[model samples]
Target: MPRKGMRSVFMKSSSPSPSNSPSRSSTIPPLSPRHTFSESLMEENIEIAQSLITKWDSNSQLSEFSNINSLFNGDRSEARQYLNSVKDLQTAMHYFISHNSSSENLVRAQFLMQTAMKRLEKEFYRILSTNRESLDPESVSSRGSTISSLSDFEEDLEDELRTAGESISEVERVSMAAMADLKAIADCMISSGYGKECVKIYKIIRKSIVDEGLYHLGVEKLSLNQVQKMDWNVLELRIKNWLNAVKIAVKTLFYGERILCDHVFSASASIRESCFTEITKEGAMTLFGFPELVAKCKKSSEKMFRTLDLYEAIINLWPEIESIFSYESNSALRTQAINSLVKLGDAVRTMLTDFESSIQKDSSKTSVPGGGVHPLTRYVMNYITFLGDYSEILADIMADWPLTFQSPLPESYFPSSDDDGPFSAISVRLAWLVLVLLCKLDGKAELYKDVALSYLFLANNLQYVVNKVQSSNIKFLLGDNWVAKHEEKVKQYAANYERMGWSKVFSSLPENPKAEISPEQAKSYFKNFNAAFEEAYRKQTSWIVPDPKLRDELKISVARKLVPLYREYYENHRVGLSRECGSESLVRYAPENLNNYLSDLLYGNGGGGSISSSSSSSSSPSRSHGRHGR
Candidate 1:
């Protein structure tokens, strides 16, 4: 009676009755687990189960929890163990419920499966809760709660579970659930001001995870400084270990959610809290103050090596500090790390500026307890040297930025760069910092009461900074153009010094034979030359230049400019000049003498020269660049 199309459809769509299907027939060979219900049979079973309810019978089909043909057992412990032992519990339950069972029986199977999962979940949490209670603050402290100690404790506790006949995996599953619970507890402990205890558990998890094999991933939770004076090596090792644990927890707990579809308490986010201490309640957003600690350490170190200034000693240290920032693989955490560094840099800049401005508040404010170099100059040098130290570190920080970045320098932190120079954004930033320090130095130099000494100090320090930058790796960061420009500034300072300090001597030199001087004027000229030459030479011989090459270059520069003209003027008019002051006595420097004079230009001389320091020469001690030579 069926239509032709309906008959064809029925033949194709219908599955054989349970008695007729090849798989269902007792005569057929068993499907060795790999064989499964066809799609239609699975759909038919799920559809039947969705439409009815069956008895929650604890006997008959539910009587065993063994092989596939075995039924579920009634004992709760055994049922709980049954759920725990299966590698794919959900898959097993789904297959059992949807393969040829009546709809009502399939529903009953899902209910029993869920019941077993809940029982196991409850038992797991119960055991771990007891373990946590036993690890109260006093107990944790007594054991000294190291990662290894906690690890040993975890092992021993889980061993007890194994002794109770739980599988190794079942104990671990329970422990993982406990660890998940510990995350919230740790967060609460931290939030409630029991951060120290939270740290203990954090270490426990971290150390526990090392064998878990994860930090071929990366992971800070602290004002890194608060613990700086602590044994950082041990703390660092623990941090690395803790990072591994977090990766494992995140992955594993995520697995629990996917496989068991249970309320797996993931502590992965809270795991971060255990890594570092925080100043505020903002959790992981706390800027790790380690980078700032590093910045401060460099500033402190500058006091020990004051003469060399800032950058030389500090540059080597940046690598270690920057590594702290780089170690945090989490992008959000790294941003906090960078903010801490920027805060440090800004703080340092403020320090330098405040120091300089305070000096200016009353130039007569007592000098700090150090020798020779003026306190103001020392302050400027420290800033220059220390900032020079910071320059490369900042450049390194900036190096991660795009080369095309045109972002302005961070507030009070970055240095000036030569826009015209071929350098990266980082390079430009370094240049800007250098320029800022130099500008401050130049301003301080201007404050010197003696116009000539101002030029001299400025010239020495500027040349020193330029040479330091050029000789170090910072040179490339600053570019050749920056060096050249600053070198020109050094020269400009020297030129100013020359015009202001030496012009009188050059003026006193005799001119053309056509312009005859009266006897009074000639005598006056000789007297003036004696006064000027002796004064300049005596004042500078004892001032320290420090660097040999800089010393030589300045000496050569003086000779190149002074020797030729002095010789020309002396030769042209010596015969016409007065001998009243005595030519030998009047001429304090011969051409050869000039060579010795200039060679000792940068270093302070101990008044060692052929030039006489007669009663005519000023007796005042020249204290501009002290004899603190290296």
Candidate 2:
């Protein structure tokens, strides 16, 4: 609306002027000639200038001068009002111009308005400079309003009025000068025991500056061309600067009234909220690129389990996270803080999930006496301990929130199937990680295929798991009874070793032969015994028994079960089974020789365990043959 009237006035003013007009020639009065009219117009200009100054000083005629003040103050609603009195005056001037009405008076009138406006502007600046004491922070509170330190102050200027350059610039220049003038005011306020007022004034000024900066960062409207041309990185960097500015303000020294301190603090909070709102509402969240960060975690762990840099990243962001709320007695802010933490928790969970997904589940489960555990399992186990070690930090973060919470938040999302036994959500999350790692190890154990070696492998890994869990924070999660259960499970695998490996060897020996037994039956018994003993020996000697104690115990058990059965059978059948092969040949092994062979099977002796066949078919089954001690 202002543009429409201004447009007409501007157009009227654009046409070239003449010194005198024909229309005035016929109507000229007796004494009042063209020169008199010229003098009257020049006087009129001076009168208008004096009236404008009067209105400015009086604060009267606000309604009449609404557009003029609004244009300067940047009040869009008032600035947009259609021009009123100025319109009628310009309309009359337009009529004179259309009839070739310019005379010397019109020329001076034109020059007069410019001269008056310039002079008025000069005095406006002087008065502002003169009243600088009122802008002082001490006087600021007593004065009606705060003069903010603002950015983009001239950005909202009306397009039509941009040509009104001298008037517009002068006003803005004065406002900025007021701020500079206020600096001495600020120092004066401080030196004169008004530090509290100084801080309060600083708060109002900083808010306007921050709010304007924020406007451009995300909230301000832009043409489609502007949007397309925007460099997204530049926008994000600006937002970061605002956030940093707020942080600096929070840490800024403020020895002032609590009210002023509260204001500075509140202003800082509002800026954070605004920046975060931009992130959430405008999808500026991509600025943070959380998914990409999580991907880095995945890549790191995938490269090597020891590259757990996510922990450091979390630590680095703690201060940002810490500054989210005041945590002073406001329940709503406390609630807000909790909600923010939940969002942060989601981020942490993403990093952890990346870690989990990257682990090579098919990797081996090796645990020797000193070291052999999988790195992921070690990392997972140690990380769980780390969580426990710092759980209090998390607790402190949520402590205020919990007091106002209606129901507790879920600690994890593992979604357990067992309904009866309730575990802490944190415990479940950790357990899931540990068990997934163990499942990977279990797959590796099956690779051995040998029943005894598979059992040995499983035993070693499970033992390591149980021992580490029991000694650390994990003990609380996995209960004390879990160790005994796992130990018993390991023993079952060992029991399987006895049944599959050694029981068949014992089956070959039988009770003593009766007197009625025929020679053929006795020879059959002796031949069967020789075949079974040699078969079991060759198969088992090369098997690894990493535990030396277990290896010795197995050997002793086999010896105790077999020796007596052979001794009883030897007295009854020795004479009969002997004659077929010479007594020497019949003695594949004497009782004592059998004892020695079982004792040495995979014993600690360092030779690569191959049982060589050394037959003595001609030797008698007697003391001399047995005593050879081979």
Candidate 3:
């Protein structure tokens, strides 16, 4: 808990202190026994007279005295002196109370004293009801006690409250003066046509309230009350209005406005200077509070990107804003846009990374595979798609930019002429790879197959371009190993596909009329093709197009292999059953054929009637050389 502001006063009072009575040696100090009794009696009489001032003040001071031992020492001289002082203090307090009876201080003072305070406060309230003028119009409300008593019975109540009030008022005056100055600055900023600076100041004040948690205090109170007593539909309408106001303010300040950088002389000379100073002011600090303010700023930044309107504004301004520090002249605005885009991208990337990490680590049932893909992964994918769409739009806009418009290949948007621009392309490729992996894991092999094929085609074309540009040497050294790794991965996938009964879909026949190969041999063909493609890439010193005819031939070969396998599979499965007679019953079963014969019949015969007559007749058991064995 925080320290109490009044603790020091209590501490000082509790410490040992010298007696108030005069020493015997001092001149005219000690009183005779009779004189002391008389003094005490007079002091008692004075207190009784002052007690009639109000029961509230008397009771409050009595209560205060009960809590402190130092207030009542039981010394006659001390009692006499204390009473005289009490009388004087009460006179002044009464004067003020009578004068400003309708002020908040009166209300507080009356509340402090349970009975007489109430009566006095009630009478003061009555005056307000009857009067035409506002009470204490010239005086602001005080936050502390209105009355001080110095009587021995009320010493604890003589708390220097008036002095405290004066000091507080002084501080308040200074703050008000500063606010006036800020208001002047804001006005000057506006009159001088520094609209952005005005908006900036307004935002600062708005944030001061929010960052201080004052906004939350109000919202919390309002929300609780509404939840308890108000209709939800009505409450929602009010909330909507509040949110709309916030949106409008944000839009007015940031959207389609150049004020942040526009005001030349006034903005540069005054607004920036004043804003920084105001931000550092003690009042600003007090109003905004520390750590909370910083936390609020961080939260608001996150929300700024989350807000759809704010995001759209950013997108719209992307072409017009330069990077905060970028020095490039032509693409300054574009660079700024890039910076903002990168910030948003980084946030998204962080979220995705966190989500991915969670999915990997979470052991919850919801994260289990058959249960569903982790919701975090699904959310990340959605965000990734959003990022992709945003990038696409950005790229389209940038395509018309001066530097990009003249380029023959828009693919230059990728860092490499053959790939995408550095940042965007890399991000996209990584996201694509992750999606493909996820799909494959989920048994959505078909989707992965399509993605893999697209990537492969792109990589191939890029390889071709690299060769054409005589850029193969660097690519060969830096990329060949990576390319080999991809090829190995693809081979593994193709093997898996064949194992899953998809060989007929992915296989190809040899165009060179080679003998029929086993499934293992068929897979080896793809591996060999991959190796040759890599070799061709490594050997190219200059631009050389791989023969298109070779590509087509390979496709045809793959198709032929798949077709033959498909026919054989169908024939084996669909062949008619044969009937046999037993001693007492008839039985039927399928007959197995030689692999070569089946292959030849399926592929060589091509489902046409080209089989030899003898073989055709041999298929019929009745015409065959079946001996009647007993």
For TM-score, the strongest prediction is 1
Candidate achieving higher lDDT, 1 or 2: 1
lDDT of each: 0.45, 0.44, 0.33
- Where in model 2 is the C-alpha error above 4 Å? 1-348, 351-423, 430-457, 511-530, 547-609, 612-630
lDDT per residue for candidate 3 within 96-211, as digits (tens), equals: 35443344533433333233323233332232233212111112112112211111123332343344556645544332222222333333334423336345534354335333
lDDT of 1: 0.45
**Model 2, range 238-340, lDDT digits (tens) per residue?**
3344344322322221111122223222334443243233222221122223222222322322222111232333344445434433334323433433443
- Candidate 1 lDDT over residue span 259-315, tens digit each: 111112122334343242221113223223334443444333233222122222224
Report lDDT (Cα) of residue 42, candidate 1. 44
TM-score for all models, in order of appearance: 0.43, 0.39, 0.26
**Candidate No. with top lDDT:** 1
Greater TM-score among 1 and 3 belongs to 1
Better of 2 and 3 by lDDT: 2
